[model samples]
Target chain A: MLKIMIIGATSVIAQETARFFATEGAEFFLVGIPADKLVVIKDDLVARGAKRAEVYEADLTDFDKHPQIIESAVQAMGSIDAVLIAHGTLGNQKAAEASVEVALKEINLNLLSNISLLTLLGNYFEKQRRGCIAVISSVAGDRGRGSNYVYGTAKAGTTTFMQGLRSRLAKSGVAVVTIKPGLVDTPMTADIKKNFLFSDPATVGKAIYLGMKKGKDTVYAPWFWRYIMAIIIHIPEFIFKKMSL
Target chain B: MTTPLNRLKQYKSWGRYPTVEHKAIHQIHWRSDLPDVNQFEETVLPYGYGRSYGDSCLNEGGILLDTSYMQQFIAFDAEQGLVRCEAGVSLEQILEVIVPCGWFLPVTPGTKFVSIGGAIANDVHGKNHHRAGTFGCHVTQFELVRSDGTYICSPTENAELFRATIGGLGLTGIITWAEFKLKRIPSPLIDQEKIRFANLDEFFAISAEMDQRFEYLMSWSDCLSGGDSMGRGIFMAGNFYDPPLGAEPSAKKLKPFVPFDLPSIALNTLSVKAFNAVLYRVPLGKRVRSIVHYEPFYYPLDAINNWYRLYGKRGFLQYQLVVPLEGDNEPIREVYRRIAQSGEGSFLVVLKAFGDIASPGMLSFPMPGVTLALDFAFNGEKTLKLLDELDTIVREARGRVYPAKDARMSPENFRAYYPQWEAFAHYIDPKFSSSFWRRVTASAKSANGQ
Candidate 1:
């Protein structure tokens, strides 16, 4: 069984990813904010055929506690085969635009905190020389949107960080997969009007799991997002600036 | 305190009738995330796939623990044919993996979209029920987490909780995970045969004769048929047949889905009657024997994805009831006559017989009887009154209505049919409550002082 650590165990996508691993009888060390929900997820993971489902409650934004969380997971599982960083917030863009404080906090939560965790996990996986690290970015990261530019900017920075990390870890055999998903129908996006463009979390979850397993460097979830983003990226700055996307 | 992820939303059961707004729709993606059962003052119910045809899956103003995110397959023993999985793992998901390994669900409901937890809570029965019994019978054990503590229950361990949780309608507590045995099949194909039955008597006669021979048997009756033509329908029976190739055919990745809800007038009695008449003649006109894939054989409605949309935005209710196989089929005949006389002809009227096998669930709907299920478009009071009249006939015959398929069964009759309600009620964790439970028990307390 693959020994895996999920940073945000309760997020819809993370839960879906955990399920994908559970089907393979992976051993999971789950970390989420709510203790009660973590226990519930652990129980569910165990039932879904996980070899072991150990849980720890810690706010992902608490940068100081990152190393200890990883230490605890390593201690519990003895070793780790994969680390899936699926914790991020779709911070309210209107608030971020209105206040510098909100923008800074959103950046800290979405990017800085993730970078801190990755730095620690990257070092650990480099030393181990055999593991996979997957992070969920967003299609918004491909090009900033006026509606969610704050979240998009953080994701863009994280995606670039992953690209560099992928290059750094290329020779070490540690896979760094950057997943960019389009309009996933998670609770974060529940209020967003659902349409044909939206993807189910389970489907995205499967894609993330498979992309990591296949050791793909960077992938757009559902495959279609890659083409959609490609088209958006090619738009002239003048046209893109004028368009309200 | 409520979690940050909590949100309020409108919820509806599969029937789409009686939609209600939930104040706290907290989705528990993990067992540990659940609040201590005692912490919540408001009513609560674990909602899994919301596949129940009625209010059993609804909580109204109460909190709904959405379990869809908790789906996972925990363990699978190919040698023993046992699969342990989280309560939220769907039948469709299970089939995708297990069917390839030559294992099939021991019991399955009509729709595969339902979660394992919902199936057990409802003690759903399938065409194979005559031989395999309800879904609860095959479940070896399950873990139920309540407000006080968590309990691991099985037939030999915490057996009372085990019995209570099955067909318990999520009131016993939240079922986290369950282990059950799987039936093995040589291939995904079934050797199927369809026979035309002119009346209800022929349905009974043919069912009795074929019960032992076929592993799965069910019939579709013409709901509008009355008098000399009453109960005219088609009878279908099947046994697993080895595929020409050794492998069970892999299912398609994409299935066609209904785009949107049709108008309420889209499916009226006239349309249903015409469709039923056409269906009645199709089998009768030909020699109906074929080796077919199990997908259509087991789940015909599944072929038309989101077919419930056909019922319209107002939604529809399926009134499925069972009467004991006593007194020369008079009770079942009366039921058909009343439905026809009411002019609420349902296109999806199914008739089947349950064998002598009894399920372990205290509130399980299956018994040694004949069950008739019909789909009726929601027409407010008119539909409810029709169901009430049907309930009277069922009560008179000492038969029971399926809570999973019933939105409005009288509390007095619920208690009478399920005398074990008092016993089952004792095991219900105070933290867990549902619209069905509240409606039934409140009325039971007022009407009969139970």
Candidate 2:
């Protein structure tokens, strides 16, 4: 059984991804906010056939608590075979644009918090000589737009950081996976307008699970989003600015 | 409420009739932050995949709590065949998780797309009703979140609320989570047999014998066969059968799909009658006995994805009525006679007998009798008049129409059919309501002027 540590275990996507592994009788160390929700996830994973499920509640944005969280997860699981960072939010775009404080807070929660956990897990996996690291980035990071550049910038940073970490970790036989999903219908994106393009959380969860298992460097949730993003990235800046995407 | 495309036509029931606009809709993802009915203007109803055939799934000028995303299995016991899951989890999802574990739903409706909450709220029955009873029969317990407070309900605890909420149609409260027993299956395949019956008498005779031998029994009646030849149909019987040693469940083959709505003229009287006539004869050539997958045997219409589109843009209403065997069976014949005279025969008509197994729910549909269900394509006032006529026949015979399949049953008829509705209304949450509830109880509300 794989010993996996998942931050943001309360996320619908994260819970589904964890469930995919649970069927295989994997062990888990879950860390997320709201201790009560985390307890539900722990029970769910155990019921789904997980060998063991231990939870730690902590606000991931607190940089000071990063070390303590990582240390506790390691002590709980004994050894980590894989790690998935699957928590973030789409904060109010209008608020972020009007205030620099709002923009930085979202950036810190979405980008800095993940980078801090990766920093600790990266070192641990590197010295251990074998493991996998996965993070749920988004296609919004592929290019910036007026609608949500603040959230985009944060995801873009994490996506680039994973790229750099993959090269460094490869020498020690560690694998790093960066998952980039398009619009997903979840509580996080509940307020956003959705269409045929918005995939359900369950489908995206299975994709994330498969991408992590294959240890892919960059993966798209619906697979078609890969080609869709490829076409969008080629649009000229002058024409793109005029189009109200 | 989310997409521009979906915003154009808010939401619809399975029948796609009496389309109503809701003031707002909230998508629930987790059980913790469930939407409170008091927060929204007008009435509120929990909507799950919109499987109710008529107005029961709708709440016009009100709010809808769409709980399709609140799907998560809370607990599972493969050995004990007991599983618990969030309310929005569909029967299809449960089947996927448990079928591999050699277990199956104790009772499943025609389609696997219906959510667990919707199943209990409607008290849906299956082909095995003669054996296993309604879906609510196996439910051990569930958490009901009402405006007043949350209540843990079961047969032994909060028993009154439990009975009321089973077929209460989402007015009692929003079910957060539910736990039920699963049927232990030796294999996923079923030993099925089909025999032709010439008339209603033959069909009933065959059913009586089949009920004693098979766990699943159902029939397909040709609605066009009127006069002395009326009710000619095929009887089907099935029992769980083990597969050959070392056989594995095969990957699902691609199914036929109805991608878009067909023109309203596609199912005209002549074409529908011809199709039904052809369908009856085709089965005669096939082998009488075969080992088949349970999914196909239980849900043949689901073979085509979105088969509802076949009814066309105008939509169709499923007319389902049941009467006890203690009364004269002539009411059903008169009902079918009216449909034939109207020249609005549907392509598919089903008949089945409900056994003596009593349901725990107060307003559950089935009893010690048989039910007949058929789809009537919406054709303005003419179709409505025909339905009203049939309702009178069924009402006078001491039978009742199914609320889930009804769009326009008269308030007086509903009052007479379920005399317990007056007492049952007391348990309804003050802030929860549905279009069907309001339509059926209009007289009651106005007479009391409360």
Candidate 3:
């Protein structure tokens, strides 16, 4: 069975993804915070027909623990086929502005943690000579706008870091995939406008699975998100910064 | 999956589509070409003139079998106005050779850089869509290299394949050659007429009336127009120029300007809105007729090369959605109203009327409806919100957005647009896929799994 490790598996996006992998007859190693929530997700994965479902409770902000945590997860899974760095905290922009600690935490959680995890996995996969690593970046990474520049800055760094990683790992047997999601309708953004074109978590989950299977380096979840981002990114920055969006 | 890596690094460069980056490059020899009947069974994307606006041209990290090297004219029957050529031959190339012989493409897209194969692959339609439909309609026969690499002459012999290959987006096979019914033209010029419409209703009235008299019709709408005048636009109608009213013939001089890249600040709401206002007010409430060259009439934007760069390094997204004409124009009007109210300034908005000509592709993005295309810059959160709202309107209207132009539609919305999506899935080669394809199909597969 294909052994898949999904970081932040308790996320609505990850739950849907776990269900997809379960249906595909694969084993899963789900990692998330709060042990109880992980257990609930684990049971759901098991009930959905995953060959084996295991969970690890760890804080992504603690960079030092990522190597050991990923190593342990890989050991339990026995030769990791794919690793999805999907855990992220969409921290409050206003809160981040008020405290440097909050801003740094956002950065560490969104970019630094993923970087450390990716470096560990990249090394592991290169050594194994066969594996895939998929990172869930956001379309916000395409360009920085005033509305969400704090979050956009973090994602931008992650996306750029992933691009560099992809170039480095292209010749190696390891494949790195970056997913740029526009808007996803999940617990994360439940209060957002209903008319907002947020993709269903299930849809995003499927895209992640297919992207790994196809070995696509970068995927814009909900294909149209690519175009939407394209137009926004193309806007003149001078004028864009003034807009209230 | 092992072959000698012929590293033609430069060939793997950029394409019309920004998302797709070249992966592997292969060179095919035209002298010793094999007409195998099953060469297309493998993951093969039919490459033509490389004029596709997106990833349809080159499959990054995949094989791009360049067909442009195989340019050869097979035959031309002047009496019947039938022209046949290798798929690699472009419309520009054909026009250069045959326009003096009083013939032109029956249906031409905005650009002449497209190949006959690419044209048929996309089932491209021009301003004359209401009258002539798409280029696929004029095609008489084509040779499809099927999945298994067998060459099948698809006209009447393999009729299903013929229809499938027409708008199949090059998924079925590579087109080696094709025969199209060309139209006879008096000269390489067009008799053009420009008219201004005060609002959406007036624009529709003028377009409907002109459709019966003119061979081609198109409209440029001021998307910035708000409130009651949301879809106000300018209508342009044209017909073949008749020898330019007894004037002495002179050699045509083509002006070319290559814009390497524009400063990110070149295109803005202020400038675009200004351009749109001037365009709308220029022909103020009057119809002006003039004789114009074919270049300006067909490809007005061709004057600026790498024009996409004008949107700046960040690039622009093209949103083209089609709403069915159910006798009530409310659906379209409401969409425009939302766009205007949203204050997401989109300057390049084109409105057109699509007739009953059907596309053979299971997931093609055209039907009997009014299609509107707009360009917007990615402005972060606000743009996302605008697109989301647009998607809702399109979904409620039971309309679909063009996949080629789209970069952010959900899988559920995609399914709603293409009900025959399952059939498309069956045709996908296991070894063939792209970032765009993977994102779409991966979501589709998961949706089905659920």
**Candidate number with greatest DockQ:** 2
lDDT of each: 0.82, 0.84, 0.71
Q: Which predicted model would earn the best TM-score?
A: 2
Alpha-carbon RMSD, each predicted model: 6.1, 3.8, 22.4
Q: Model 3 segments beyond 4 Å from truth?
A: A1-245, B1-18, B29-42, B244-270, B359-362, B425-434, B445-450
lDDT string, candidate 1, B92-171, tens digits = 88886677678899988877888888899999999998999999999998999987788999989999999999999999
Give me the overall lDDT of model 2: 0.84
Superposition TM-score, candidate 2 onto the true structure: 0.93
- Measured over the true interface residues after superposition, the C-alpha RMSD of each candidate is 9.8, 7.4, 24.4
lDDT of 2 by residue, A79-116 (tens): 89999998898898899999999999999999999899
Compared with the true structure, what per-residue lDDT tens digits does model 2 show for residues B1-450?
011112222468988898888998877877998866677658889998887889999999988888776777799998899999889888887887788789989999998888899999999999999899999999999999999899999999999999999988999999999999999998877788877787887776667888998998888888888766698888778899876778744524312221211223344534877777765775654437766778778877655655667778889888898987754478877877888899986777889888989888887778778899989889989999999998888778888899988899888888878878988999999999999999998855433312
Second chain of candidate 1: TM-score?
0.91
Clashes of 3: 28
Going through the candidates in order, what is the number of backbone clashes in each? 20, 0, 28
Per-residue C-alpha lDDT of model 1 across residues A1-245, encoded as one tens digit per residue:
89999998878888878877876889999998788777767765665567788989999888899999999999999999999998888888899999999999999988998899999999999999989999998888898877788999999999999999999998899999999989876878856766778777777888888898999988788899999999999999888888888
Local error of candidate 1 at residue A126 (angstroms): 13
Candidate 3 structure, TM-score to reference: 0.58
Best by lDDT: 2
